[model samples]
Target: MSRSWVEAERAMVRRTRLRISALVALAITVLVAFVGGIAYTAMVHAQDAQVKRELRYNAQFGSPSVPPGCTWLFVLADGVIDDGLIPVPPGFPLHGDLDAARVSGQTIEREIERNGTEYLVLSQPSGAGRTVQTVFDKRYQLADRRHLLLALAVAEICGLLAAAVTGMGVGRGTVAPLAEALARQRRFVTDASHELRTPIARAYTRAQLLARRAAAAGLPVDHRAGLDKLANSIRGLGDVVDDLLLSARLNEQSAGPDGQAVDLAALAEAAVETEGERAGERRITLTVDRPAGPLVVTGVETALRRAVDELLANAVRHTPEGGRIDVRLRRDARGYVELTVADTGGGFDPVEADRLFDRFHRRPAGPDRSFGLGLALLREVVTRHGGTVEAISHPGRGARFTLRLPAADPGVVAGAGAEEVSTGFR
Candidate 1:
């Protein structure tokens, strides 16, 4: 395996592990928060119930001077106050509630905050127009609540950390099999393509020789035509095998330190030149527009060249006779090298645009139908080099394919002034 392929696999594994860790941490965080919220709420409710029970009991039966701890009592009879001699906290013994209970002859209860603590007060008519009131302090109960909260916060943090660690371990084990499977698949493709290339080449050569000999021997027109068609079919098969091999190799390539700066403008010019004769036979006009300076991008040069050639060849094949194909190369404002191949041909359905680059996807039955490997391979090459490829078309409106790659450092392109020349082909 290439270093780039190994690095890509490692990066994928790392990303998967991180995502798993994040999900685990999130689940744990939500669980801790929910449990903590419920615990705190239940504690507060229990404390309120206990405090109310104590206050009601004290109001009904406790003496003014001998009330329970954290409790105080007061009595009002015939407008005479009977508060205990013991010192009372500020804002104690709510006289309004006492009077309201005496006049209404009913129980009254309320909670008030004072003296840096919460107090629950209850007032009720004892008998014969007598009113009794009791108060309970909630400072101790509040302290208990704070302690529980602090413990829960600590537990939440610990749980999150544990979840993240566990998730990472689980993720590594989970993704190992997937990574191995991908490695095996890539190896199989490489091996199979290598095994098939020589045979396909030989078959193509023999077919071509047979056609040439049949023509030279003055074979009948029909026999010669059949041999020519056979030769063409073998040639097409060979091309498919070559494309498969190139696709596998490009997948393993990366724009690492081993990559070289390639002039995209020059590649585009060469592709157009290579396809010029075929386009001429079809009476299709081929043209290329490039910047005066080399539009440089970092990648494997042969791969980039093949990608460019595929784009031009695809355009030539799809375009009708007398149609025009334009190739343009330039560095966009975003500091990326952009190459576009636009052809005036019978464009495909707009819905099929996204699937155009899918390997072996069947095209609409027409003269433009293809084996469907070229665009897929082109996409593989561009993506491996950190780029994007897209197609735009409307049926009968022609199609445009554009690929953009990260431009190499300007300093490198500046040094290649020797190859900076304008190229234009008709």
Candidate 2:
């Protein structure tokens, strides 16, 4: 896919996550506000109703008059206090909004402060243009409301925080697939670059030969060698491309119908046979040590063959002329099989040994070195076969490269229930 298209999709996912989080937060805020408003109004309503009922009962019954924590003041039409009532509570206000209540003979409730105490005052017209005011202390009710408001505020904050955390998780989850795709794209590019270096080198070498020939002789040059080199380079490039595509396909197939079981020992022997000519060209001594039992593994035969070829080729390249190269295959007690390639070459620094499997990584001291893709390709194939590759070397000491794979079970058709293992570089 195009980079722009991928970016647009990711942007849309991010926006969706943000919108979902915002909607959740908004819903919670609205719910809390609605519930809190109802609770506050109900609390105030109950307090007012209670005060009103007490006032009306005392006025009608005239028995034991005012209730505890409540006070009353009756203002007659001539502005005189009623002498028939009991004494009012200390710090309670005598004057309320009498004029306002008497204007329409309706109850006027207001919060009043007198002598440093708060009260809920209800003023209403009693009769004959007189006003009766009822006062109820509100210290405890106001405190309760404050605590309720604090609790609601805390709840609102917690709800917002939870929404934010959930939004972050949603965003990461949404982007995970895109991130994996981008990673695969980058890996393809790296692998392709590493593979292309070979053809480019071949082409450059052929061009140099043509240049030297033209410089030596006059005008018309022989196109045969040049054409042959060009063809070989193109063929090599095509082979690398095929190998890369096959590697990708193998990696992509997680639990599909993988190929049948192949004998690993036979594969290693075939690799040794194939690489024998190449080692002979450099006068290198190559040997293979096989275990008595047949070492079988479940994987693609072509891929496994390529893996062995790459390993042997690597050992031949690193080993000096007439050096010894040993290929050994062994099965351990833990039902794991290992293939080791130990060569008596001028070894590299052990610290940098692990980087040998990385694409295009080359040792500076190596002579006539090609772009480093052989080891990397080998690692990829082995990893797909549920195997791991390891590089063991030290400066001045020969390098030992090993491939460890899960051994196939002896029973039940001898090959099943195997999974690819994640591996590190050789």
lDDT of 1 by residue, 1-426 (tens): 555567778887888888887888888789988999999999999999888888888887898888899999999998987887888888878989999998899899888899999888888998877899898888999999999999988998898788778767876777867877887887788788778877877777788889899999999998997787676556555555555555555544333322566888987786676678789999999999887977888766666777888888888888999999999888889988999999998777888888989998657574454688888978877888889999999578689999999998877666554443211100
**Clash pairs (backbone) in predicted model 1:** none
Q: For each candidate, give its TM-score against the true structure.
A: 0.62, 0.48
**TM-score between candidate 1 and the true structure:** 0.62
Error of 1 at 331 (Å): 7.0
Q: Per-residue CA lDDT of candidate 2, range 128-242, in tens?
A: 7677666666677678878889999999999898888777787787665766676568567657756775666566566656656665665454455444444444444444454
Badly placed stretches (over 4 Å) of model 2 are 1-259, 364-369, 411-426
